[model samples]
Target: MTAPFRPLPFLSEARAEQAAGPRLRALRQAAQRAREAFTSEGAATALATCDLVSFPYPTVFAFSGAARSPAPYVMVRHRMQVVRFQQEGTERVLLFNPSDYERGHEAPFFKALREKYGTFVTTQVMTRRHGTVQAHLEALGLTPEDVDYLAFDHLKAQDIRRWLGGDGQPAYFPRARLLVQRAEWDAVRCPHPLERVWYVPEGTGGVPPERVELLSGDTWLGQGVALLSTPGHSPGNMSLAVATADEVFVMSENGVATESYTPLQSAIPGVRTFAEQMGWEVVLNGNTRENSLEQYSSMIVEKVFAGRARADGGFVNVHPSSLLTRAVMAPGLAPTITLPPPMSGAFTPVAAPRHAA
Candidate 1:
């Protein structure tokens, strides 16, 4: 008789407790000051007031205490910023989160965050305004009419479809060759729809030869840089590790957030299920959707602790939660990129075997 197939166990309660140890307490303390400033001055003024802002969420605090099991965590989907940096006269401009397809109607939400946080948060405004088609043209130093045929074209139709729902034709963008881990790619294509849904591309074609490079094994990308395959949130989701001149920054893509601590008072069951499938650990911060300063502070503290511990010896920085504030604040500390040495022995792919559809 064949043994029954078993799923990986969720985070154990014991693990969760350990995860929220003393390190978490320190982070919470730091977050308290930030949260107080945000509430007292409002998000915008508080952000403008900071000497150096790292992750610019409108507010950061804790809401829930502990959970019985390691179920998927839920985070409040608030307005966020997309960050990118260039090496100055190099072909490589490290693009953080690219321009999202949803806009126009979504501008109010974005505007609200900006209003609360301040205008320091910069987005690929041109892309957000004109759509990815035009944005990629600008990236390649070309105009829409300049190229005879669009190359390296890979668009995420499903994400577009969801956000655009009943809107006009979904936007498309130039396909850059991604440097994703093998396990991450498999998780992205998992049959469990929500597990890898957000970033699962409908198609990947029109790729340019010059722009595509695949990293097959455990290897660093740039000098003293590594890419981690963090699969809980999205399948192809990965974080960047940069050991810089000053500190080590791990750019976790879809990890936990301050809002994830809130209780599920009125979350859509379907959306909650989706969040779970994507591997989030949600807790209730309050009985309502509205968050309080204390709760925000607690959550931020937890996130910081977890983020730092995950970085181990490296210093860490996260993408700002509030876009408006981030745009204005100077990049805070030098980024940290930590890469644990590869395990000794022949490398084996960590992906589960793909089943026939």
Candidate 2:
């Protein structure tokens, strides 16, 4: 069996918010301040808004929570982002964690989850736009072949075959090279017991070997674009560190939202409780409970890198609730919080993984 699910340590705070008291008032004040950061008029700047994000969707996992909802449990979201820039004067288009490959095959992703979690989950990806990679590229006025490179923080719920092709299907982005960490690739072949249900069927089975550029540890796909292994959410879990015009942005699922890392200070009740008790760094992602200790470490690493790398506090979590959509044009979807500038320097580079079976 997979490791036991660790319940959030802030249940009391959630309960506290229900009662009328000084603590409740304080918590409500904090929560309100946090919500204000997501409004368009807030202009809360830490990390610059993303250049382009794939269809923003809510994918409720077996026990995931909806964005900003009172639900303190349940992992959700799972969105993607694509970046475009020039390296040494060469135009480059990089897709970060490209998902929603084929709308035709959404059921299998959830079906696999049901098999492993022993419960039916609503795997639907709620998107106002088309939920396909092509749609993302189209929004940017580009095509799959135009993509210079592709990378994923980790490949737990991802289906590379969706883009690389499988089961006799043709590759989605024929010209792009997949920059996957060697450790992440290994897990794709032999997933941990807890991860069996998160991936797509035959996800990487049909990829052409030449299309993959596997790295043993941290690596640079291009100037100012790097793949760093953070490894907590999944053994091979990693983060993308990109130095952009606005500032440096760290994209990882570690915290899953701006709410995870902030003001060494925050207003959200659960966040405030965890921050006060566990220390602000104790905040972590909504998924993966097997290695709470390690995940905590990973989130710390993420906080340091993200906090320092950007100013606006936009860690660019793949699963940030709609309430904290850093750059969206919608209400309650704009970024609200900007952590004080990162205090520390860059984190130690990722080393090759030492797996435990």
Candidate 3:
């Protein structure tokens, strides 16, 4: 029998937020102890990121909690993170948010949004491809087969057919199994009227059931890696936490930029004022409002777990999977502080398993 994913103790904070007093404090203290133990286990062998696409994103959604902005849109860069680590003494690879930029139009929301408001609102800024997932993997000395698992922070605007061999097609990552939250998987397949716009119609259709791994809650993957269940941006929303030689980095769409995690320190025009007035520590990526409070709590979990940047203690090391980037197309919406892509160690091919003679 296979061992199950170890649960992180910090998750109790998700439920503790309702009262949010002494009980919450007790839960947090225990959670911090768990975090310390988890971090002490050591870091992953290697981690790297690849830029996939850059496009205009609504200022309203990017800074939902602090929505007063002159700019309607902010240019954002969506990236794929590849992490290699040892599990049971064997090298394993995890690909987080490996979005296929070319097929992004398949999502009903983007397709109709582009068709109706393309000229006035977005125009050519809807989608911009930087490189293919295959190319990036090759450049890093990795092949599709080397990837053991594939996961996304959430399933919004994603079409997994190409990667998982759906609808009578061959898979791009032959050996990869999708690690998704069961709630997210269910929501994507049959979204609520409000949630429909963000998902591709029939996106998960024909995906081989055997290739999908449904996770129930926060999961510890191995030395230095865990998936934090961060619902609210979307039901079953999750964030990837990875420990490196320098520090741990949490990746999620729950927030757009570093400022999202540290709103009090933000220099963006309206971010600081809104956060101060609302008494908010973190600004949410509020595409969905169903679980805003829970999402707020989850971002807290990510911030606490990621801790502060080693070089500059001002910002927490919470990296958005689709990080906000400066674009000529979207003016007046530049991130006050930008972090260079996080990297650690080196990427090398996974050794083939030995066969007994």
Candidate 4:
């Protein structure tokens, strides 16, 4: 069972270390600055309580089978918060996928796939049933009674199409738009020529209403900053780099693993191969075995950290709640930053119960 959502305090150090880039030298410099800031600011005793908001998104489950079966089941893609910020003083959560949730298990399907395929090829398959509901409603050209269902299917299908590089009609959503890098946009030919698509440049833009901001640099919004493309995982997988008065942080969702040891390089192969038929460098266990658990784990950690920063008074809260806590409480002591456990339930895998043969 997942724990109830709780507003977390900020990391005081994050504010001071906000400029830490991807380089080790920058990271070390940021750390030092964070320590100094903690001593001067005088830490707050109690944590702040803030309202938490999240978008509803579907969950994915992966299963593995034998060679003779369909293909090796691997990887799941669920909606997750990508970048968060304040709109007119109200906290807004930007979701990668906002859609209706469905419950289905993939284990049985894997069993059957293994039986038929012998050595299953690496692939992630969605049930035909999943797509049918959306197709029927879409063909009508009339909005379905449940807009959520339609939206869910549209988003899921888009993800699938993008992965497959298929030439099917592009999916469009009036309420939300795809926030993509300039390079990615360059490669894609808009199926709907008249449809408007917002292209975010590499870093710098106010959070525009109804327009997704594609960022390229480290720029701050109300509470967070946007970090552009840090590819190695996926061509388009990008992260929002952020910091406050004390600590520095990055939310590289699905781009890196939550666990400290595993990096995004480890999980990219399986999903990349299944989705795009492209070979990737597997940094985790050298074997090209398909598994993305670690990759998702790493992403979850970044998500929680970002969430906590928001809940608290931005990055200032990060340090006191994290490593610089002791230093802030007692300035003379050696600065030792101990990161808290990641926000709970940020990356729980959806389990598929049973699939029909």
Where does model 3 exceed 4 Å of error?
1-4, 10-27, 65-67, 117-126, 354-357
lDDT of each candidate versus the true structure = 0.29, 0.49, 0.81, 0.27
Which candidate number would show the highest TM-score if scored against the true structure? 3
Candidate 4, residues 242-346, lDDT tens digits: the string is: 333444444343421222122221232233233233222212211112224333322333343343343343222221110111112222222222333222212
Arrange candidates, best TM-score first: 3, 2, 1, 4
Candidate 2 lDDT, 1-357, residue by residue in tens: 011111112222422444334533443344233222212122111121222222222322211232343332332334455655434445456677776444323434455444554542322322223345676466545666667677777776567775777668888777777777677788778777676655555678878887787765444444445555556677777676555434445666666456565524444333455456555454565456775554555454444433342343334222331123333322232333533321112222113331110
Task: Please report the candidate that would top lDDT against the real structure.
Answer: 3
* Model 4: how far residue 270 lies from native, Å: 16
**Native-vs-model 1 lDDT?**
0.29
Instruction: Quote the lDDT for 8 in model 3.
Output: 72
Per-residue lDDT tens digits for candidate 3, residues 303-350, read 888889875788988889988887765665678888778788899777
Angstrom error of the Cα, residue 142, model 1: value is: 10
The alpha-carbon lDDT assigned to residue 325 of candidate 3 equals: 83
What TM-score would each prediction reach against the true structure?
0.34, 0.63, 0.92, 0.33
Worst lDDT run of 10 residues, candidate 2, spans 1-10
- Over all chains combined, what TM-score does candidate 1 have? 0.34
Clashes per candidate, residues 3 or more apart or on different chains: 50, 11, 0, 49
Estimate, for each residue in 111-217, the C-alpha lDDT of model 1 and write its tens digit: 45456545554333211232343444354443322221111111211222222122344323232333444444344344343322223343222333333244332
